[model samples]
Target: MRRDIFTDEHEAFRDMVRQFIAREVTPYHEQWERDGVVSRDVWRAAGRAGLLGIDIDEKYGGGGNPDYRYYAVMNEEFARAGATGPMFNVHNDMIGRYLDRLCTPEQRERWLPGYCSGDLIAAIAMTEPGAGSDLQGIRTTATRTGDHYVLNGQKTFISNGQLADIVIVVARTDPAQGHKGISLLVVERDMPGFARGRNLDKIGLHAQDTSELFFTDVRVPGANLLGAEGGGFVALMQNLPRERVTIGVFALAVADKAFEDTLAYVKQRQAFGQPIGSFQHSKFLLAELATELAVARAFTDKAIAAHCDDELSVQEASMVKWWDTELCNRVTDRCVQLHGGYGYMREYPVARAWADSRVQSIFGGTTEIQKEIIGRSLGL
Candidate 1:
């Protein structure tokens, strides 16, 4: 299917992202997987290539282009390349918004330059040891002192935790107010008593660093507060739609890649003196998969457009997140079955994609969560 979303400029940007992945991501991905984290050098290279900060202002060393299509292009290319190691989506899509939109002038001057330059790797520490998806359940607390907030909490499954120079931590400021009490604090590296636990051993996405972060009497300066003292929950909700759309787009792109790869595989690998795809079952299956993919692409493209216009709603975003990710999982699973034993091999890109795609539906809010949000909006 021909996607009408991209113009010549978008395609040109896609080419640059493809080249950046080829030069900076692909070669080192294997070693990174073994090392359990990607090198910060690639992050710097991405910054230099104008891939790190597409929406950030140029004065702060960013691309200064707020158009969302450019980000969509980058995510699609990353999915196609099977380069899931970098958390560029997390950095550029989620955390960048808080910095770009809400940061005070002084805060922006202090952080935006390195953030755009990749000198300061950023991560949002929202998921805690006990909290996953339920923001209200977070136990991390930030008690105000005269000049700083004394933070005490533990965050697990933090992407970029080990490498983050700046962490946007979600903590309770006035516990009595529940959600309204929550606030965002900028926790910088090497702040006294701030510590990172070991890089976690995960089932997949090995090159991406996931770890536990500890803050015991960690003094975060009052100036480091991201937004209004208790406006963190609102800020999180505002940016979540973009983050969810990013996941949906990535899911569709990767499913398309898997379909393309599997289609070629079925044509060449002979079974019983004929290409397996020649069989009736294979043809019907592939036909179904192809149709499903096209259907998803159509919806996903529209969601991206709505998101760019800042017109996307909570319900719509949830629908896109649930449907596309579930479809991505379903499509990849079928493609793997079509590959038979070979699909199970770790060496094949399909195998890695299968593993990587699992977390898509799980993270960015679970599919069940998306459905609940949608259901509630409908007066369920």
Candidate 2:
């Protein structure tokens, strides 16, 4: 399917992103995988390339483009390149939305410059040991003091945890109000009693650093509050559709890439007397996958357009996230099976993709959680 979502400008930006990845990321990705984190220099390079803060104001060193397609293009290119190490989606799509929409003038002045410059890596600490999808169950609390909030909590499974200079910590400000009590506090790395526990070892995305963070009586200034003092949950809910859309976009991109690669592999690799793809069963499988990818792409692109227009509902975003990620997982698994023994080898891209795709259905919100959201929206 021909995608009309992008124009010449987007194509030009895509060229720049591809070149940037070829130069700054592709070469070092393997080493980064070994080191368990991407280099800070690549983040700086992304900033210089105008890739970090596309929607941020130009005065803050951002491109100042409000178009979300630029971000979609970046996400697609990164997935196509198999560059999973850099959490640009987390930076541009997730935290960027919060900072762009909720940051006060003072907060923007203090943070946006470094954020746009890639000097300040960012992460959002929402999931805790006790809470993953259930935000209301969060136990992290921020007790009010004179000029500061004494924050004490632990967050695990935080992307960019080790490298984050500014973390948006979701802590309860008034436990009595339940969901309304949650608030966002910007916890800087140098603040006293703010500490990173350990860089977690994950099954895949070995290059991306996910870790545990702890705040023990860390005094976050009242000024560090992101939006309204007790509006954190609302802010998170508002931004979640975008986050889910971002995940879906990446999933579609990766599935497309995996399908394309598998198509090439099956066409050339032979079994018996001819190419494996010549076999009726293999041909039928490819046809089904091709159809699935085309349908998924069409839906994803529509969702992206609706999202840009702010017309995407939470239910629709949940549907897209779960369907596309699950499809991506299924498609990658089949692609690996098509390759037989070679697919299981670590050197094969499909093998790595198989490992990497496993987490998509789990994060951003689990598949079960997405279904629950959709179900509730349907009044079921």
The CA lDDT at 193 in model 2 is 97
lDDT of 1 by residue, 1-380 (tens): 89898899999988888989989999999999999999999889989998877899999999999999999999999998899989999899888998998999999999999999989999999998789989889999999999999999999999999899999999999999999999999999989989999999987889999999999999999999999999999999998888899999999899999999999999999999999999999999999999999988898899999988889999999988889899889988998999999999979988898988888998878898899999999999
Off by over 4 Å in 2: none
lDDT for each of the candidates? 0.92, 0.94
Per-residue lDDT of model 2, residues 169-248, tens digit only: 99999999999999999999899999998889988899999999999999999999999989999999999999999999
lDDT of 2 at 278: 92
Q: Residue 133: error of model 1 in Å? A: 0.7
- Candidate 1 least-lDDT 10 residues: 356-365
